[model samples]
Target chain A: MPTITVDGRRLEVPEGSTLLQALDELGLLMNGVDVPHYCWHPKLSVDGSCRLCQVEIEGVPKLQIACDTPVADGMVVHTTSERVQRAREGVMELLLVNHPLDCPICDQAGECKLQDYAVDYGLDHARTREPRRPGRKRVELGPTIVFDEERCILCRRCVRFCREVPETGELVVENRGDRSRITTFPGTPLDNPYSMNVADVCPVGALTTRDFRFKVRVWDLDEVPGLCTGCSKGCNVHVGVARGAVQRYTPRRNDQVNETWICDEGRLSYREIGAPDRITRPAVRDAEGRMQPVSIARAIERAAERIRAAVLREGPAVVAALASPHATNEDLTELRRLLDGIGTATSGAAVVEGEPDGLLLQAERAGNARGARDLGFGDPGLVFEKIRGGGVRVLLVMGRDLLAEPFLGGTDPLASLDAVILLDTHRSALEQVADVVIPGRMLAEKGGSMTNHAGLVQRVPAALEPAFDAHAEGAVLARLRAALELVLPARSEGAA
Target chain B: MVSTLVAQAPEATVLSDELRAAIDREIARFPEPRGALLAALRLVQDELGCIAPPTARAVAEIFGLHPAEVLEVLSFYNLFHTEPQGRHEVRVCTNLACSLRGARTLLRELEEHLGIRAGQTTPDGRVTLGHEECLGACGYAPMLRIGDRYHEELDGPAARALVDGLP
Candidate 1:
């Protein structure tokens, strides 16, 4: 470890660590110190363009950018030296001369680096009386981003991202001197799946998300770290909630999986979770075939009695379990245990398959197929084979949308079975065919865990109450396990 | 419909020889011929009032790209304009930071003076008023990008005068 002094404070840091890293490790606020940075995200590659991270190395005459400059043993760095502060303030002042101050209605308010730097460097006063040069025409970059030329500081974060991260070179800075502005090639829209991230990474309000424009202020929303349920990939995300409802989804950095980027589908999918069509209550079929609301206990008892009778009539071999990849690992484990205890053979998990566009949507439509496999459920075809065999007379379908399957087609899969029990949150074709339907709670309404494609288990905390007499899949399975006297192992412990 | 079609035609002639020469210098920098399309379009837009269809088609032809491709690219990026505009274009950033600081009020004032909303050009072609999501100059919320210049710390009156002063 190399020892370094910052702002008169002495501390030892590991060799090869940058000063910013050391400052972060020490938990010292680095805002007041003169550090010129643009395109140097702590997590991303260090291009160090803005020359803002200027710091005084004890022996060196010229200040160095802390981000690109690595630390050496016995190095004494002065981040708050007058020379360094003046250099940083000069760069910031220049950056703002043409830069627009639109914080009031800008989406990046409170979180923008320009605001933070301006406040910290005390460059609030404008010295230049010259009229600022205007930028090019305002361009609608894509469905998600709009470009303003004048306010751009020419940091090139969006340019670097398009060129390197998404490999979609849709943006580039054109012209020189007063003519320079970020512009894309003619006919090329910024249509990359990760384009919205550029808006998030822009230090200033240069890049903005189309979906979030004028919707809600960043200060008005509360952010909750959660996993994206868009697909089996399970990208980590922060769900922004406002007024008791989710406003948007932003990617959370996870080194093992998404790595600070999420697909457009995942970012825009929050609205679907809170959609009005979501089934909120458990319903049972009456004599007239109408789905009537029932108490949670009544629904559980009805499901248990039907399963017991079917097992008694046709033995455990006659009962089949149709699992869904959408259920969490804990819920899957409980359901498997309950089925096994009832002498019903375990069926493989069912998953919706879609075209893989090589972005984020996997071939598997369900978000938790990998988790179900981890919990010992294999192939859905095997379960179907068992059902087709003479022994299986009843089936319990959990979370699978049976209506979408060609085998069920217009007919309900449950209609063919002697007894059908459906546990799902959506009123799909499976619910219609099911002899008994139990309204299941959504992932946002439950405290459980899911395993993403990379086998990372992510914990999801309940954010809202389940609507319409629904219960979480885990709770419903727990109740069924109790009725069946099934013993299952405790939740698997690990970080997701 | 006829007026819109007429508006879609080239509002100005192709880039002048001087602007074309400047663009050609930029084109020579890239190994790939198509790499300079963005620079060329900016040059063309600078020379002409805005990017008209014929002007875009000429630029696309020079770059060996389809006119439709050039139009798509022009429409996709915010810097290029497909339609005619006022002598000055005033774009106010309305992203998160600016929104919190009241960029909306500044934008409304600009629109009121120009007598055109964001994304529209004034009837007299004096100013094209628009709202940008973010211009990366978040520290100065309520900022406007006019012509090739950025004006920050703007009040309603200041923003209105800036647009009104455009040639």
Candidate 2:
């Protein structure tokens, strides 16, 4: 351990720690002193190119870049000294010399590092009367990314990220000096699986995601920590909401799952959260054989009544529950409780399994398949055969859209049921045939825990209200259980 | 419900056989294929006069590196050109010592004589005039390099003669 004094506060940091890391450990980043930086990311290799993290050290002849200087025993570093501030200001001046002043029209204006540092470390006005360098604007780096050359300070964070993290070196610095800019090799644009992450790591408005370029400003959007339900990988994410709409989904840093990155699939998967076709209210078929929106209480009462009548007439074996693996553990557990009370067999929860890409994407496309299986939703292969054989009467389908899935192999198996109760968030083709529908919440509109494929149970919080007065799956299930006078068994302590 | 579309894989046979063989030989000499990048690029540039974006991509595939990495290395150096160069290259020194000794006047004369400014090649692709910081011959003052050889102590007429004599 090396004992160091930053400003006037003394602290002991581990050996081999850089002065930047030591300051970070001392909580001095946002407290009293701030070291401005561009190329020095906590997850990336230190390039020491930005020259913005310079600090004065006692007994040292010159100021040193805190990111590259290793902590030495008895070292005294001053991050807020007048000399250090002047050197930092000088670096800030040079960085802004060629950088475009279009923050008002830039997408990353509110969250830009250059804008943040300019408030404290920047010179009030430019000293030179020379014109700013004009550059190629809105260059499509790939399908999902746009590059603005004039805004780039050449931090190389995106370059290092491509080489070191995803290891797809598609992006490169082309040319030299002032003419230098980031570009992809001819015919091979930055089309990697993790290419959008470049926009997230860019400190300025140089790189921006095409989907979110002019959608909403960062400050106007509300960032809510959430989990990606794209697959069993459960990559941690932040839900960006504005005006009761999902603007974007950015990866939240979680070292155990996705470390500062969510795959392109997960990142762009936020499009379906508040889609136009989302199921917003409870509906049931009227006497004219057409489905019409109804009250939640009436829909739940009719569903329970139909299920009870089917059980009494055809026996419990004819009424099967087909829940989805996409349901949260709490939702699934409540679903199992209701099914047990009715004395019927469950078709079991299973989702379409895709091959894992060996990165963050999992083979199981279901977000909570592990939790559903842990809640005793076993193999549904046998139940599907029984349903196709016309032995089942009343079927309650939870999140999965059977008519949409090719799993039934061109056969409309759910069509044979006399009464079908579909509880889902999105409107699928099956809604045309189902007898009753309950508008359930999407994962983004619910607060529950899900077990990943690795058996890691993580909390998924509600970022926004349910669409069209849709209730959370848990709340909906709990209400249905209450209507049926079914009591859930108490969960044991520390149980999954 | 977002779609996951995978990018098409780069073609397997983008490089010429001779270039591939040369890159393979360079790779065999180094412990890691990446260690041969600079040498392989240099060899390609020497044969083609410049490395285009497609050529850089082919070289990157050969070395199992990102074309961006190859481009980063290629762009950092002034010697490497990404476009076609003139048949005969001329570099005029313009460092502090050379500039103080009227190197700027010599460059202006050469530009007027060739009818093309610095960084531009002659219309017929016979010669290219470029200004470099220093050719490591600052003592020579107003000097120029023709291809790889340096010509020191050159007046405006002498430099014009050197360009005029180029075949």
Candidate 1 chain B has its poorest 10 consecutive residues by lDDT at B1-10
Q: Candidate 1 on A352-409: residue-level lDDT in tens?
A: 7766546555677777888988887777776665665645676778875445654344
Q: What is the lDDT of residue A469 in candidate 2?
A: 77
TM per candidate = 0.71, 0.91
Question: Candidate 2 lDDT, tens digit per residue, A35-69?
Answer: 88899987788999999999999999999999999
Error of 1 at A230 (Å): 1.7
- Chain A only: list TM-scores of all candidates: 0.88, 0.92
- lDDT, candidate 2, B42-126, per-residue tens: 8889888899877877787777666667878898888999999999999899888888888999999999999999999998999
- lDDT for every model? 0.73, 0.83
Residue A85, model 1, lDDT: 80
Runs with alpha carbons beyond 4 Å of true place in candidate 1: A1-36, A42-45, A70-74, A135-138, A355-361, A389-391, A401-411, A486-496, B1-167
